[model samples]
Target chain A: MTDAIQDEIIREFDGLEWLDKYGLLIASAKKLEPMDEDSRTDENSISGCQSKVWIQSYKRDGKLNFNLDSDAMITKGIMALLLRVVNNRYPQEIANINLYFIEEIGLKSNLSPARSNGLESIIKRIKEIAKNEALKDNV
Target chain B: MTGFAKDFPILEQKVYGKQLVYLDNAATTQKPNSVIDTISDFYRTDYSNIHRGVHYLSERSSERYEEARKKISDFIGARNPGEVTFTAGTTDSINQVARSLEPSLKGNEVLVTGVEHHSNIVPWQMAGAKPRAIEMDEDCNLLLDSIDITKKTKLIAISHVSNVLGSVNDIKKITEIAKDHDVPVLVDAAQSIQHLPLDVKDIGCDFLAASGHKMYASTGVGVLYTSDRFSDLMPAKGGGGMVDKVSLEKTTYQEPPLRYEAGTPHIAGAISMGAAIDYMQKIGLDKIEKHESDVYSYARDRLLEMDNVTVYGNTDRMCGSISFNMDQIHHYDAGLIMDKMGVAVRTGHHCAQPLMKSFAIEGTVRASFALYNTKEDVDRLIEGIEKVEMMYT
Candidate 1:
């Protein structure tokens, strides 16, 4: 399933120039579902990012849903790209899945390390949330 | 001079099929061939430890290193080479002073300008001193009137030029104020040294720090200049080469500069720094300063002409850097687009988060000029920014 998603993302970005990829990311950001103002709290905020980013997750019918936003357009766009691979996926699947889409799409090196680190943190936080949700299901 | 740009080899490259327009001089400068070759040549011919080895290589290397020190001393117009101590960089230099002087602080606070880089502020805080920031005007100019250097104030540290704003602070006046209060002043000259002709004697500050990398030299070498009075302070660190006589009970230490150097210094970096100073001398700082000022003003004027473009800094005082933002455009987005267009500008807070927060901005796209940069480069930046605006809008 992870491979399928990674392949889809790679296919989506294949043969696109750097500017085109950036435009697509920005377009994805424009299409992202806006999170409630109240949900954008410090608890959901991620540090070590040059731009401000917030991610919130909730469990629904054994699946975890994610919502993320960033103050900077590029950061928001990157977050939107990452979410396309993991959002609305099962907790166990999300907890176990390794998203290689960033590397496959050449985004791992294309963007600055700070933004890449932010992407990693977003993924890490999502996985952590999924892992917690999986444990709660067992309990 | 057309031949001047040829001195820097890295500027020859093309980025994304476009000739690279490097405007990130404030971050770190591309080294000229002379500085680069000096580093390599020193390693190839004269590589040895100084102050201890009795061998010929040691003596030659030591003499070269000391020669480098004398060059830097002359470069900054210091009273003597004894007043200059080589450190890793500006941050290391400031930390050494802050740590060494912390024990003697019989006061409640250390005063710093609000526009200081993190390097200047963090040291005083790390040394357990309460750092009170002197207020700046809305335009980010230091409000000299807001400075309250009271009896409780032990030290006043200020940036000679603001890293973000590129606004040259009145260090001489600030130093005089500190003098009237009998408080010592430390001037961080990291931003000013490259674009301005600096004379420590004229500045009249007790201490000053500057990095070599910012001035066309290799990294890992910087200078801490102290007046004769401040030179009496104890060494910041203790190590092998800095001692005169090592005893079981007590070890006699060397004097001020050597005392603070403490360990095996950055010999090649220091030598290369001297080469860099030589390069700057050959070009003449007065000429470089004027050229940069003209280029910066030209860029600022052109940028201001653009609709909804907001440029920062006091234009009358800016040396070689300009920070600006386009209407409703994120700095990172603009920076990314500019990068694609092969114009390297720094985006983000520029290690001046306090200054950014004061202006209620996340970051600004900073296009800083070097002596090698021409009006053509500024035009390229202006065109690239226009492209970014078009793409985003």
Candidate 2:
């Protein structure tokens, strides 16, 4: 399914060279709210990534909200993009949405198991969180 | 320095609209044209399973394989070709030693330096042995006089060069001490085989392990040099070609090198190693060592001169790799930006978690050098570091 936010991301990255893309990502990374040291504990840390990544989630106003942070700027930048597409969305909506922008923006290579970026692992964790939240809503 | 960059066809290419400056030689060295041609030529002509056939083609293939073994045997100064057994790589060779010496290594300790890579650390753990790091000072220099070998220290496995920090440990001194204690020592030469001239006999180590890929040859082939003292060690792996007499109740294995080689080996890869050795020899190891040392020192000096960068590990003699980090910058981020600038480097713990713990840091950006890399590559790396620092500012 076509997503408006995903399409917008693809358009934003269009016609940019590799260095420019990285520059944009670094800027987005800076825009993300800093994660506190207490919240960046081992429990919140995501393993299998080359960089240190932490994720937090909570339900607000019957919708799921998420926050993610990484020590690496490019990784945090990608997390910023991901939050724009899925934050504050209903659990059921998040569980079924396709993040095609990752592929369209020349980042699909980083999602492979071979690459140490752990982009796939982050996406999986997001889906798992959405499924659990959706199940709790049903209960 | 010789114009070796032209010999590697892959170095001429452009990455990200810039000249690719490869500084990840510690991970793997690029193969020369002679090595590449040797692999293809072997496949085109002498492509057959070795040591098991009796036909003309089999004889030719077996002859070529043994010839490669002889070349390798001489390259590392083995007493004879029989002392060297071809394995998959350095990890495989180390695991073979661990497996063959399982009876002695299990429940014992293997003394290692604080700067060993995981390949040297993990195999001993998998073999049911604990790895204890020898004492080293803050600069990551091994304090040989402070080495404590206990009764449980059955073996000492150390790396000749640190893959992450490029600290060259004095394995010869360790061997001398190990001899007095009657404890066998294993030298991991995966990082040293390409950059420095090595002699197993001169080093007096019981076992030495090195990889073909790291020495500008093909992957899937390596050498495990076992001293004649360990000739009777049990085979780590049991298979068809390695066996001599097999029955329902009894099985006997082949002798020395063939005894360790379990199945059909990488025939072409081994031949490629022969070509790589020939290529390096023709260029002269003395010349290669001098050139690489010059380039390596220049790189280290330039990185040290950078005010915003912190270089890791210091030693009187260092080569192959130099790890550094910029002020308030993550190594992964620097590596990503450097990749865009066509300066390929390695970032992370570099499979040396213990070393990382000693430094109390997550990781560092490692720029490893090879014979082909020149001062120009180091200049490119400095530029990449400048770009990262500017981005942060």
Model 1 lDDT on a 0 to 1 scale: 0.85
Angstrom error at residue A15, model 1: 1.4
Highest lDDT, which number? 2
Candidate 2 off by > 4 Å? none
Best by TM-score: 2
TM-score of each: 0.96, 0.99
In the range B294-368, model 1's lDDT, one tens digit per residue, is: 888898889989987898866347776789999988888889888888999999899998888887898899988
Please give the lDDT score at residue A106 for candidate 1. 74
The stretch of ten residues in a row with the least summed lDDT in candidate 1 chain B is: B312-321
Model 2 Cα lDDT, one tens digit per residue, A67-101:
99999999999999999999989999999989999
Encode model 2's per-residue lDDT on B240-347: one tens digit a residue: 788899999999988989999998888888988899999999999999999999999898889889898999999878989999998888999999999999999999
After superposition, candidate 1 runs with Cα above 4 Å error: A110-117, B1-3
Q: Give the lDDT of residue B104 in candidate 1.
A: 57
